[model samples]
Target chain A: MNPILKRLGFRPDDRVVIIHADDLGMCQATIPAVAELFDAGLVSSAATMVPCAWFPAVAAYARATPSADIGVHATLTSEWDAYRWGPLSTRDPASGLLDDEGYFHRTTPAVQERARPDAVAAELHDQINRALAHGIDVTHLDSHMGSAFAPHFLPAYLAAAAHARVPPLVPRLSEERMRAVGMPEEMIAFARNIVPQLEAQGVVMVDHLIGMPLDRHEDRVETAKQLLGSLAPGLTYVIIHPAIDTPELRAIAGDWRARVADYQAFCSAELRAWVQDQGIHVIGWRPIRDVLRGA
Target chain B: MNPILKRLGFRPDDRVVIIHADDLGMCQATIPAVAELFDAGLVSSAATMVPCAWFPAVAAYARATPSADIGVHATLTSEWDAYRWGPLSTRDPASGLLDDEGYFHRTTPAVQERARPDAVAAELHDQINRALAHGIDVTHLDSHMGSAFAPHFLPAYLAAAAHARVPPLVPRLSEERMRAVGMPEEMIAFARNIVPQLEAQGVVMVDHLIGMPLDRHEDRVETAKQLLGSLAPGLTYVIIHPAIDTPELRAIAGDWRARVADYQAFCSAELRAWVQDQGIHVIGWRPIRDVLRGA
Candidate 1:
């Protein structure tokens, strides 16, 4: 464990922030931008969508950079109208995962109503196997959308992650597990119960992580920088979607411009300086892997 | 589905490269690199490590970017010598998951012998629930270190993914699934068998993907550029990892620098120019999602 992280203090001055990139293979516009930032030492890490068509390209990169922190984006619910994917398992037609066009249904509810854990895990394994075959060295696992975390799907998600042996994005906790099963609880108590369960699960926990709203470009950047500046040293992961504004992306995604703006702000020299000024320690999975190995 | 994507074939050009950045919370070095890469629009997507201590930082970013394509890096064995994590489910002292230090043993073999799918699924669900509570918009699910893909854990991985309703990267065909079952074959045969299963499952399929050794960064980038220049283009997911270099990373990992180098080449103006020059459309999940919905 990081010495500083091992003894996390409450002071904002002793904080370490992990600036993460989301959607490496979701589109072409996003890839290059992600690359430039990492090359320039502006960002720390990024993950991929194994189900999308662009994964081969992503895998090649991961293979070449055996050490770059990488992970599987547990996917479900193809949300785009024009673009979508289905489960990797074909044994269950009753899952209702596919649409009339033979593509994955676009909504989480559709999946929730139809899919089963058996089929979902088969497909999830397929994606990871694909990455492995491609020589993509995956470092961890995460959800593509919140679909895995939904009340109905939580149990299935955990089974898959555990089977995979890769650290998941969220800590597994009994109470949280209960909540996912649709149990109602007092927010404070629920949150309180969550910590112990998480600890027991060997999950890496944190006090907070900040989110960025697409429309709020300026606020996104400001909040990100502020969050980075104000972080405590235990371990924090901050996510971002950086894409270049292009005609194709614009036509398909209305928020491409905002993503680009956020990207621009994040890669700016100012933010880098802020991180430095804040005395924040920027690190990656290699160390964590090392620490974990040593532990 | 960009009309252009439809117009193109999937053999070479038709692929959507889904390059995923894995291990978001593995260490401080990885997180920022991923975030910057996202900001730079380098890759299409990324995922998070739920078990690592730095997860909150990563998940917060996922929450902020509702549409930013992301996923869960399902975890199990902590495969490092020093840094280690164990099953969220409690283990008996005799389970042997613990290293000398009492954390979960760090390799797949160790965990494989001792882990039960039920316990695995429970942990996977807990991780997903945690991400949901933290607010992550995940796109898919996948494994870490191919642990779940191993024959011993295949069923567990499939069950979990199916239950979660997320698309697993692996295809559910005989030949393809056989790979997970340890029946390896030529790449061509593997690809051939995979297509049918993916189609039958209503799961999206990739034309092809490949991985290379880290030291062969030049070959990897050059090959990718060549591949992209001649890409078939229906929709392919290319996966990769982007990270900034640091001493901590160097000590924790071996061969990862090549990944950093590949990331550099990926974001190069020359590469971006090559992509544009070839008229290959790079996209995020929005278009892919839209197309899948339409499909």
Candidate 2:
């Protein structure tokens, strides 16, 4: 049994789920939709990208609603062309995180290949510290585009979460667990070996992670229903990007409609009803953080 | 004879004018209006607020149009309630430039009371270097909200400009000039003695300066026509804040219509024709830099 979940006092067979929205402060579209889902108690948690243009809005909300189960979505990539942001810390420009254009590179592979581990650590520390300073009682931590999932970044990522006394969304891995998801053999072996080292440091991770396949789906409602119905009996994080389609979002993101669809699906009353009908126990990161850090 | 204008090979009675647009990158509204005036050759030069949201747009334009006379508007004020920005250098938060809300103070008095002179110099240096790194052949430096005009900041302001080999917008002050303008007795006395010390350092200063009343005017065309006609027979800077009256600007600034009026006046064919008729030889800071730096 997972120690973090055991501390939360959930049995091994009990089905617990965290409907988590990603990219809370990326643009004009994301925050409002996430707020709506959060308000309705449909999505119990969200991760905020603090360096984006809409961060002040999230900070405003965080200040107003201090108990919101918001995590720092530690960002390294500026992915979109028209909408780009730079690092928060001007303390270190030689951090290898910035390209020649002085913006962060748009890909995880580039971050892995080009960025120094200490620089990566510095940026991550800056992001988390920025949120905490913004008055966010950050419940957990996660990565944008899996940038921290790279082997080189894993230690820094884990250390940052530990330093902040927050749970990270790095799942407890095993060969069976990785192979169950059809991960590459080498990665499965690597992740399996690394999981225990992280677990030993009192890191909190979901028992199983799900809902990535439902992303950018042709039929979001149907896919969302399928995702909700198929929730296995254990703690799982079902990730989604919820955003209302606005002209600003359209200009900023190419996948604006996908975001709109995700927003619609998550905000759907049917999805809420289906969770209850399926007897799935919905949870947030607050309890997990309490269990991990309090221990 | 005007010493600075004389350095530029202008006669004593040349009546040189720089139709200088202020706040080129302060918001979404300002850029397009400034760009149009620059394109039509109505405005000879424009200062850019590097901390503002629209800076990247102007930087892109400066890159594409290499000959544009872009000067960094050394900003210490974030003025408006809704639209706010902070410093470029994160190295010194203890510098006291940031207000309680983490934005720059909205007034020069606040800056004088709070900001460290060294930090002001660092911020100004960083802004210019950021522009240069963005491929802007930055022509000069100027202060936003006259922040650098405070007696406490004047030395750092001039030092930064001199260090960059770029001229600042400090006019050479004299008692007669100060008394003529109805300035305070104390300031006039201080400025009378200080001007010669600055001139001794080979610091380039404008012989005459105008452009205060035209802001927020109901009839900008009439005001502009009058301003050009009354220009002294020396180098003078006519500052204006031009912007298309967009909803964002309307929401951000109460003086949006005045900005629109400014945009209209500078882009107006009648104004351009009037300047030509008045024999005001319109020039930019590029020539001033040429004379001042001899580079």
* Alpha-carbon TM-score of each model against the true structure: 0.46, 0.77
Task: Give stretches of model 1 more than 4 Å off.
Answer: A1-4, A7-13, A99-101, A171-195, A218-223, A230-233, B1-295
True interface contacts reproduced by each model, as a fraction? 0.00, 0.08
Candidate 1 chain A TM-score vs. reference chain A: 0.81
Per-residue error (Å), model 1, residue B269? 35
Clashing pairs in 2: none
lDDT of 1 by residue, B83-126 (tens): 34444333344534445433445776667667665666666675
User: On a 0 to 100 scale, what is the lDDT of residue B111 in model 1?
Assistant: 70
- Candidate 2: fraction of native contacts reproduced: 0.08
Model 1 is docked with a DockQ of 0.02
